[model samples]
Target: MKVTILTLGSRGDVQPYIALAREMIKNGHEVVICTGATFQRFIEENKVSFYPASADLMALMESEEGRDILNGNGFSLLKIIKFSKEKIAPSYRKSMDDFYQASQGADLIIYHPKALGAVDIALYFNIPCICLPPVPIMYPITEFPNFSLSSKKSFGPVLNRLSYKLVKFSELPFIKEINDFRGKTLKSPKRKAGLYTYDINGSPIPIIYPISPFLFKKVDSWKDSVFISGFFFLDSEEETLPNEIENFLEKGKKPIVVSFSSMPLKNPSIFRKKLVQALKKTNNRAVVLTGTSGMRFNQEENILTVEKAPHRLLFKRAKGIIHHGGVGTMSEALLSGVPQIIIPFAVDQPFWANLLYKKGYSIKPLQEKNLEVFELVQALEQVGNKEYIENAQKIKNIIQSENGIHRAVKHIESVVDNIKKE
Candidate 1:
């Protein structure tokens, strides 16, 4: 069978689906990944067919407007809607065209919620589409509001369920372009506004959420079609640390690994200065991962900075993990059995950070605006507290036991088998 996976947003969002594609290929199926043009080479390097379905989000995040969104204390659902309409709406035609062309002759479509075209595109082809959000935001949870919209007080469960409408709000800005793609491009029937959620067969689409049940179990309210598969990690080859990193790791205490992953920092200089001072004040050492996230720092005697490293490998050697709480980073840290210090920027990050802290996998999340040298030092010192470390290891054992990619593949095959029976 030919399988097409569609995703959007940052590398954090697209990386897991690439893992999923590889799993499908291992099962003797043709696999294609339709994502940003930036990932075409990366996809092909992994031996999966590549199709550019969206513009590179890294470029967007680097833009001034995108920086504003990230630096904000928290992103309200309303702010995201405004941002998407203003920045993302203009690119819809090209993105829809890309997805339309890439999806041709595919038996299945598994998509990130950001891949809004998948719903209509699946309908156009009469194929099954599975919603595969790497994060738990797309499914409603009774405990909290969606992502960054959470407050010090509860908005209550009614609003908590409604907050997952982030998917609908995020896509609202592109509806006109989606309609244009339907009418002018695909010659497909125009569907009404709101989420184009149901499959062509008039069934509620199945959703596969790749998160460890230990982090958040399947709630009673979720439907039969909603699955809580464990995290889908790539079957990575053995990787070696760089000479600089290797030497640094051997020098002193196992240093904390600090990375904000793909989050763009608005004031990186201030952030980096505070971090370095905090580490020194706590007399702890660190290895900072500074990718294109705008966190550039000169290597100090006690702190080392590298552009990239294998998180799965590097995290396990660290005494603690400090990061922006991207779902990908969260999963890797969980698997590493290392306690985390989450400095959430925006969106679902706050949700995950709070959850981890409450569950004793990490310290209480520190907001960037409220960030201080003393507070950071306190959190860094807390890293050695035995209780948090023990809880992290317990969660790690539970996640390591579950086979996320294998379980996800089984579900995909089951959906296809059901289609055949029909």
Candidate 2:
């Protein structure tokens, strides 16, 4: 069978789907991944076919406004909404056209929610399509609050309902706009200008959520169409650590790994200086990743600073991890059984940090605007507590025991089989 998968956003969003696509290929299915053009080389390196969407998005994201959004300040959501309104349609349409041409006889279409046109493209072709959630954006249960929206307080039944309406209402305009574009682009009268909302109890195709079930309160009434696949992680591209780093890990004191991940800080030099001061105060060995921010620190024997290292490999040897609470980073840290200190910047990061905190795997996240050296020191100290390590290990055991990729593949095959039966 031939399967086509579509996704969008940063590297965090694209990586897992690549893992799944490779798994599908191993199972004797032809697989193609359609995402940011920046990942074309990465996808090809993994032996999966690649389709280009928008390289411009990456360039736009590296600009001043993008850096601001990454730093958790100033019109981030509004800017994203505007970009989606102005740019997403044309890029999505072109991507769909490319997919349609490439996947002439494909068996299934799996897509991210951000790829608004894929659902219609699947509908137009009368093929089965599954939604692959990159984060906890859509809630399958009515009782749970949609995590996609920004809330000032802890979510409850009242808040859940309100969040549902607010999210659905906010999406209405873009849904109509995309539908209208699809109607015109495809020249099909069957396509209508409207948003499609799915209920907890009703969905034709399965929704695959690759999150550990232990993190959140589970709903008994969650629809059968919703499947929980433990976090999908692609094997590291850099499987080996630098010899010096490996040798350093072999030394007596366990090191704390600090990384901001792909998100660049606004004033990285100031952040770096503060971090170095805090690390010196703790007297702990540290490895810092300054991604594209060009943060340079005085070379010290105890501290190692580099531009990048594979999280999958590096986190395993670390005593603890300090990072912005990206879902992908959190997942890796959890799987590594290392306690984390999350300093959330923006978007769904705070949600992940809060969830990890509630589950006892990490401390409450330090807000970037209010961050201080003392707070970083406190969080680092908290991560060394035995109870947090014990809790993190328990969660890791649960995650490792689940066969995420196999379960996801099984669901996709079942959907394709059902389509064949129809």
lDDT of 1 by residue, 1-422 (tens): 99888887888788898888999999999989888777787788788999876656666776776776766736577877787776677665678778888899999888887776777888889888888888776667666667657634457889888886765566566678878888887797766555565334467778888988656663656657578888988756746789999999998899989888778776788888998898888888999999756777775878899988989889999999999888898889989999899988777787788777877888999977757889998998989999988988998998899988899898889888987898
lDDT of 2 by residue, 255-327 (tens): 9998887777667777777788788888889988778654777877688887788888889788889888888
Most accurate candidate by TM-score: 1
TM-score of model 2 vs. true structure? 0.89
Give all TM-scores, in the order shown. 0.92, 0.89
Each model's RMSD to truth, in Å?
A: 2.7, 3.0
Show model 2 residue runs off by greater than 4 Å.
Answer: 72-90, 140-143, 150-155, 165-181, 190-194, 197-203, 236-238
lDDT of each: 0.81, 0.73
Clashes of each: 0, 0
* Poorest lDDT segment (10 consecutive residues) of candidate 2: 192-201
